[model samples]
Target: MKTIRQVSMLQFTLMVSAFQISVAFLSLPRELARQAGTDGWIAIFFGWGMATLASAALVKVMKNNPDGTILDLLQRYMGVWASKIAAFIFTAYYLLLAYDGFMIATLVIKLWLLPSTYIYVLVLLLLIPTFQIAQHGFQAIGRYSEIVTLLSIWIPFVYLSTLRHAHWLYLLPVIKEGWLPVLSTIKIMVYPMLGIGLVFFLYPYLVRKDKALRAMVISNTLTCLVYLGITLVCYVYFSPDEIAEYNEPVISIMKSIEFQFIERVEVLFIAFYLFVFSCIWIPSMHLVSMNSAWLLGKGPERGHLALWCFAVAVSFFIYRPSFIDAARVNNFLNLAGFVMEFALPACLLLYVAIIRKVRGEKRS
Candidate 1:
């Protein structure tokens, strides 16, 4: 087996964190309100707490098997037949997520900038460089992630400056629908933290010894806080009616900002958004490529091939014939994503814990 290059713990954390903030920050508030009404932010907090606990369990699984990826550990702990089934399911989920990332980028472009832009051309432009970086391996991707992380922090500051424009009165009458609505929204809120699952595949490749668990926990905690903050800000800024009416509430919030010299803040928002999209797309591409390479039992060259295949497949399949179909499909995919990303990891953690206990008792 050709060894994958090692990345630092900090790099791993930032790569995951930056990607989490990207798509979630742009659209989550709207999704939250649709599901949880006035108590959407509270649902987000609850979801984050659940996601954090699940992530910690996953990290424990990784730490127990220091040099093994989830696939490797699955095969060792379970039978070969069962492991193959699990691996295939996970691999499919990751590929779908990569495609979803591509689709989202194209969707944003079409909705906000150019209605007539070709999805394939946009996907091609984005993927070619991503393939090149994936070929360079994880270290290059990590460095790029670090740079984007610094830029991503500035986004919240920009959003925070728009607070004065937000209607604080909109956030009144908290949790009017009570606990049931808030609990229901957990499913939607937890989907944003799905990037945490990437750690199962990448943790074995980290350079730092025994720190993956701590790093991931800290990273996830910070991401959850950031997401909750952004969602709350949107909830307070826009009326429930206004939030439901807008597709991208954050961008709409930015549009509401104005000054004498700069006529539009949306342009600045788009530039930062492009940076975020890049951060999200590259790591997603990397995960798909690396996992595909592992599955095929091929050398590093196969990683390059995997990257191209993923990029091409997504570009072709993602362009819906109509905008309405695209929106419907995207919403369905987001809901499906909660299952693959959150529910699957939680199940895997449970499996691992059961196996460990069984093994311990047999030994005793």
Candidate 2:
């Protein structure tokens, strides 16, 4: 019997959007401020364009072989050895992405909400839910992402509240330093936009295969709007000089919002973010396991999922990394993502086009 492809286009799009809006979104305002000052929000548009182009290229690559994942394409067009290497690289990339999400969530939780909680305990807590979601495969992950996206709709509205005190003048003097800084900040926009790479594995599972590109574009558009809206709110709410001072200006600005019932909304906001943040590691862990299994020529076994969870937990325990270490890992992960997510698809598309043309000519 053939494996049924159960993920629908809507679920696939939500999964992509959820993956893009990750732990990085929390600190995005600060990074933008440091890189582009008040004009930082403009960079998101340029980032959106870049992300769209990359997604288009990725879509074309998948279109050439709609039934196969990247691993299958690589093995067919490249070779078994090359495909194995690609699989290994993908597994590592997904593992690092998962680890970064896990570490950042743990650190954020420990620092803001649970100061006394042991790191191992937090790691295991995070892993349990992730393992549960990932073991069920793409259908479950897509459904979970759709549910999380629907439930978390209130988050952006909460951010909208901070605009009451917004100083629109702060956004004035736009491009005060010319366009170079704003353009340069486009690079900083990449990490937060990294999650769209989920399409590499998910394209084969999409129910409406022809609409995959449209779904990806919609996903990137949603992500761009969210990032742009929040960054603009931050820019106007906080002074040019003050915005860069906070580690996470998006969360920090929430302190100004006052309500009768809730005393510390930011605390609750941070805690609830755990749900949004889980979207990252959960899908990421599944990607890691899926790619690793493909690398080993194995079926989708739940045993592989359990083993990876144990490995991740042991790695965290062995190192017991601090916030600084997590920051370093984030940096490395961003660099790897540029190559794996952004560059690799474009390269594959070029290779596939050329090879197909040559083969067609020989047949003629």
Best by lDDT: 2
lDDT of 1 at 172: 73
lDDT of 2: 0.86
- CA deviation > 4 Å runs, candidate 2: 361-364
Tens digits of per-residue lDDT for model 1, 237-356: 888877887888878888777778898788767755776777666776666666666566566744545655665656566645444654665567567766766676778777777887
lDDT of 1 at 4: 68
Error of 1 at 50 (Å): 1.0
Instruction: Give the best candidate by TM-score.
Output: 2
Predicted candidate 2 versus true structure: per-residue lDDT over 1-364, tens digit per residue: 2485579999998898888888888888998899888988899999899889999999888887788888888888889999899889988888888888888888888888899988778999889988888999999999998888888899888888887898999988888999999988988878989987888888888889889889989999999899988989888888999988988787788788888999999899888888889989998888888878877877665777899999999987887778788779877877888887899889998898899897773311
What TM-score would every model get versus the actual structure? 0.89, 0.97
Q: How far off is residue 43 in model 1, in Å?
A: 1.0
Clashing pairs in 2: none
Please report, in order, the local distance difference test score of every candidate based on alpha carbons.
0.73, 0.86
